[model samples]
Target: MIPQSHPKLHRSEFTLGVLAGGSGIRAGRRDKGLMIAKGRTLLERTLERYGKGFEEVVTCCRDNAWFYSRFSSRVLCDVEPGQGPLQGLSALLAATQTQYLAVIPCDQYSLPLDWFERLSSALSSTVIGVFATDGGTHTPCCVLHRDVHSQVNALLKQGKRSLMALYECEGLAHMAVPGAGMDIDHTDALHGVIRKPPQ
Candidate 1:
């Protein structure tokens, strides 16, 4: 069933929270968001997914927001330094005016355009949160009800940065995303996004 058909929720009211808060330490403090593989910045590539996937597209970055001007006002960086992604989730959640929000990482550039269709089909009103999976729960890729306040807030108050803990929400479900599960750890991240590897 579509979220629009839910008795309490509507698709138009949902928000897409694109979490891009990391310092890109994995890529040697090189500003992973600005990293270019195929002439497109990682931030720009990631935005393309949500720009087409959801009604609201927001990027949570550090300080430099001008590079993302094409996305302009919709782009937001961390207000309090070193607060971590879980901490930033609250701020992004507050920025939206909806009951349903999908939290996806900027590292996933391989996400399919039809990804949301699978998410909507796996979700209904009762589920509190759901993750996009290829075979198991894609820890970094998840969707949740805005009411995640109580649990997420409590974790934030305690200063636990791990988002996997947030999956403890009531009735967590999983939705398969196929080729969309790729993560940009090294240079190989780009290989999966546009090419089909040999058998």
Candidate 2:
């Protein structure tokens, strides 16, 4: 249950964006979102786990837009190709039509079940965004108020493509969740093995 101290945000005000724009050099150039994990595509697992209660779900990808479109309400391509997740994030931010946007990488399948809830609950009128962290910050797994769009655009204009830069610029709060934020960056991770974060 959500604490009463925070404003009760309805799911209708939120849109979920799955980041899938990586070049996938670690996954043999395949679309990481489409890779199989525990008998389901990473994309499928993501939607099944976090798709409920969002106003809509969209995917940002550099390729396979048609395949991603089949699973999401809309599919977006990165605004600048090969620039990395920051470009994809910029596109997602521009495309979001809801008051709030929540993002998760398609390859991170073991995120906390309450991931969205935890992030959303942490958001107040003053707190523009919240992201998950175990020890290191998971910048992509975040919920942002629509008002942050201008900030993101400014960062992009300055060629600040790093997510951590955006995190610090926005003063985003962190929600610590153990055993969360690990992503399948290698081919071996597809076979049900959990990758340990760097110590």
Each prediction's TM-score against the native?
0.79, 0.89
Which is the leading candidate under TM-score?
2
Q: How many backbone clashes does candidate 2 have?
A: 0
Q: Model 2 TM-score?
A: 0.89
Can you tell me which runs of candidate 1 are displaced by over 4 Å? 1-11, 135-137, 196-199
Report lDDT (CA) for all predictions: 0.66, 0.79
Clashing pairs in 2: none
Q: Which residue segments of model 2 deviate by more than 4 Å?
A: 1-5, 193-199
Residue pairs with colliding backbones in model 1 are none
1-199 per-residue lDDT for model 1 (tens digits): 6346544434455687777777766666656667786787777766665455367666677766776556634778787868777776787777767777777777676667656555666666677767777656355566677777667788888877765666665666776776556667666456654443211
- Please write out the lDDT profile of model 2 over residues 1-199, one tens digit for every residue: 9654767776678999999999899888988988876677888877877677887888999898899999989999876677877787778888899888988888876676777877788898678888788778465888988777887788878988887777787556778865466777788877653332222
